[model samples]
Target: MAHESTDTASENGPELQRALSNRHIQLLAIGGAIGTGLFMGSGKTISVAGPSVILVYMVIGFMLYFVMRAMGELLLSRSSYRNFSDFAGDILGPWAAFFTGWTYWFCWIVTGVADVIVIASVYVTFWLPLIPTWIPALVVIAALIALNLPSVRGFGETEFWFALIKIAAIVLLIVIGLVMVFTGFEHDGARASFLNLFNVGGGFFGGGLMGFIMGFQIAVFAFVGIELVGTAAAETKNPEHNLPRAVNAIPVRVLLFYVGSLAVLMSVVPWDRFDADNSPFVMLFSLAGLGAAAHIVNMVVLTSAMSSANSGIYSTSRMVFGLSTDGNAPKAFSKLTRRQVPRNALFLSGVVLLSAIVLLVFGLGESKGFTIVTTISSLCFIFVWSIILISYIVYRRRRPQAHDESIFKVPGGTFMPWVVLAFFVFLLWAFTQDPDTLMGMYATPIWFALVGLGYLLLRKNPKHQQLRRDHEERIAQEKREAAAYLAAAGSRKVR
Candidate 1:
């Protein structure tokens, strides 16, 4: 059976043990998927497609459901599949593993930077009204690094409560919005009608074809961390059971939290008034005559940003650790502290997050930082998704029997992968259509080119080459030994 192999002599620490429980896995999955992007960006999506934004979210959710299912089937096939990167290596090639691991690491780093920028802005709005935004950004980075250095469960617990707050806030907003829809308390005495879905629109596709298409840009952001559940497989108490449940529930949770909430927002307020500058949740409460609504929403958004940053720290560390194990990163990264956490990797990720603070301080403003980081992260997500599809294609071709045995398969398997690939291409095209996103879209290819160059350099490293040969020799020797053992046993039985 495939299982994680520990370097016993390399690190003798309390942290090297798996300590996370099923509850931690469940909540971490929730926290990972629910980020500030959904909380703050949903209004912009609504502005784009008006009421049809709901459909955009639902469609994206449906497609991502299949993606998660694919991941689940792959992970469950072998106890040795530590994470997606391992699966990528097994199914695709060593190079695929190197690319997937590093790409994912970079993705989290970029997303963490975005979260830092946003979190700094939120803090600036309250305590440090006159302080330069970068100060708070640096402080937030330092604090998160401190938190993560302790233990994995510490990170998990923090994220659990952070996610719980956001979940509770959304539940409250949904309940209140429903009441407003039914009771007509804040509707200016107009009867609540289901017709609101179509009544306030310039038709359902509110911004026309352009708007409908543009909705994917925002819709995809909400699904950015959906794959995070797969990362927790290594730490989960019972991955075979917990993973399936978490994977299956992604679609339903996304529908309830995204589509359901948007439906209420449109019913209570005209979709046109769903401002991009402020949260729709605050708008709902403000319209309902609550004076403290803005502050309340700000608190929720704060937690959302923290949640994203927290997840970034956790996922990036694991990615780096995976890379280290594969000889694609510095060996020191795989070193764990007493808590079984990759302390070196965690510190490195935190250090990278400081770039966000620097961007806020010396380069762009906070808003610009958010834009740049988010765009880069989104592009990285596309890269990761593409790797998964490529890996799955290879897995199916190489192990036809194993592929046939998967209980949970990606629906429409071969065709759907192509369709999703095309959809991502369209999203890239749409990114270029807008002036704001065009530069970021162009920057993405440059980023990949840099990664490719790095891979070439790593490939040439003597140490890495030796490690690769060693790993191959080890596998071949193991196979030969197994065959010999079986032959000897058969001869004895014949005698």
Candidate 2:
């Protein structure tokens, strides 16, 4: 209930330092774009969609690219904007910020839950074998919070190494898979050839319509963290250059990491042979006569999940800070530690993550409840993406001059949002094709309704109203000063 603070330093200053560099931004972008979804989830994608999973990854990448561009342009439009929530609030409304900010927070929280729980299982099964999974899950959650509590650079460095491992794994897979394919290497009496892709069981579209549709459900999860680049805009020095570079490289990365890896993987190990429950990378390594493949792949998967959970803590804490700054959340969330990280928000986020461990304790998680939770998380992300596109459209309509002035412009400005939106609609329809995804879509409304109710409640608070009024007034004042300065400069030039 208490909103005001004697500590107004952050309110009047640039609270977060720009400690992330080009390399940090690049690797973080890669880490955010790639997840355990590629390493651990692709087997199911290959098994269910057959070779058509290639197209599924391509399509998802294509659509999400526009979303990232729109986000990049939006973030670049204003210097003071910390994340999408700031621009959303200024252009769309406080309500947009309230919803999008919280929804994004919800997104990473859900994702982190799924990641930590899986990491816990991996620990218990592979290393501890005799210990309870919940213990490991708790340990992971605590460790992420500790790692993140230090500084933003720590988070960046952590992701740098994590992303490096993923890149190494993919490169290794592609190199080895290509060699086997070209040499016609035989594994378990099955020749590793390009023909292995379509020659086994069913051809290219082996799974047919339903199979391809199912790919979207799993493949979408691979892209859940891609937009995390937007959240980094404020922390990256020279965001104009760094941010666009990160967003633009996504398609190429998708091609290499998703399409390339999967193509080579199925070539090495036939799609039919890929276990939906296991990592194809490990399988190929084992077949390549590497006895330590399982252990190595297990380490990669654990690191991949740890990277995701770490990102969740970083993202959710920032989002909560945004919400709190906008008077949409508790003021405690805005408290920044000496290190400039949102310590209180991070603490609260980790505290809530215990629910993930709880879910695992009750016979959920790993593959069973994980599928459902991730589906719902995917649904939340789709909503957040839609809001960004919609916000971009509004920005163009209401402030075309701002778009004209933007340095890193989103190509096909006016028409692209519609294209992205339509693609999203198609994806939603695709979700309807499967029971699990359909349930996720159905559950979305309830989440939004709850958020809307919270918005209404927050709007009623006197302090919230005052903050909104002051925020609008501040914008108006800045606009007037800019216009007057431009007019005086023009007159002086004419004289």
Candidate 3:
């Protein structure tokens, strides 16, 4: 296949320029994956599953690796797939594109809100230990909005550093944990061994079935940003090379940072003693006699939250931009600023995020904010993942030649898709298994119904109809041009 051309010059101004480098793409992926979810939520998972939380993370990480591999294969197979939504549309149908794009957009919007809440909570440590949480929540929302409105690279660079801080912190924790395990340093005058893996409850599956299932509740959060690499494909300098490398590294990173660190943590302190309300990393630092452990961990968690929110903005804006380009959203969103950034779409996302702050101000508590936003975000992820599997299934059936030629094919291609689909269905069922998540599960279809209604209303608009027609025409024109070029090349060779 021909390499995809970087045609940003055709765009109106600097706004459409492809400015991202390999460093940016790699860091963005890292930032997107390591978020507040890992920092704060892991403690809950560990508490629930004890030592079994490690396996829960590993299993989820395994499944997500295939998901990313499937995405990578499809993306690398064709230059036209700017992102996963485009691939969904091309491989499945327009409805797939529409649903996947908007669903993914809504996903990040909710996730961003959750991050905003987390950021507010983190700030409360110093600002107002007793003040109502909503005050800081609103402030955080405003600050994030201001940061996002500038330019895409500015956002990318900021996220890069935010993610870097979290990455560095996690690395340091792991290294410290390893040293303590090997050298028995700070073992409180006792020898520390690698026996913590089984010390919690006698084995790796220490938590049993209930603990395992409960672990999934929080473990899934760690994989939240795994799909983010696909979102940055369009902006990467060399997506074919960088995208695959970045995506492939996900599983290893999960195992190392999540499973490895959690193992050491449980070893250092018994699983039963792990605190659910606070970060285990912070707790570990405190146990290790670090004076500023709480403050340092708080700083790391704050950066982690910022990283997640920044990625949420970037991914949501791109999804909206892709939707607008495909005639699913307003034309104004498709209009890129001089920097090649989707300023209008980014601004709209900021507006939605700001609304979450408004909700907070009106007495939406932190727990409520998390449930409302994270559940909504999770629902969107379900929709996006479902589309990918469905599209892969379609690609398998309709385009056997392409399937055979794919460079990075999803293993167990035919059967694995069904298995993954079943896993998703199980997750949806799991959500409904509990009263808390049940609400989110029920809320998902309502969101879909709203999207359907909006589509119907917008379909009637003359401008939207015209844009759709124009997009279709453009696709046809591109195909014809490609075919003619191939035909001319064939004729020249024959002559």
Per-prediction TM-score, please?
A: 0.89, 0.91, 0.87
lDDT of 2 at 371: 65
TM-score of 2: 0.91
lDDT of each: 0.76, 0.83, 0.74
* Backbone collisions counted per model: 7, 0, 10
State which candidate, 1 or 2, has the greater TM-score. 2
lDDT of 3 at 178: 74
Residue 450, model 3: Cα distance from true site in angstroms: 0.5
Rank all candidate structures by their TM-score, best first, as comma-separated numbers.
2, 1, 3
Backbone clash tally (model 3): 10
How close to the true structure is residue 432 of candidate 3, measured as C-alpha lDDT? 65
Please identify model 2 stretches exceeding 4 Å from their true place.
1-14, 198-200, 466-495
Model 1: lDDT to the true structure: 0.76
RMSD of each: 5.1, 4.8, 4.9
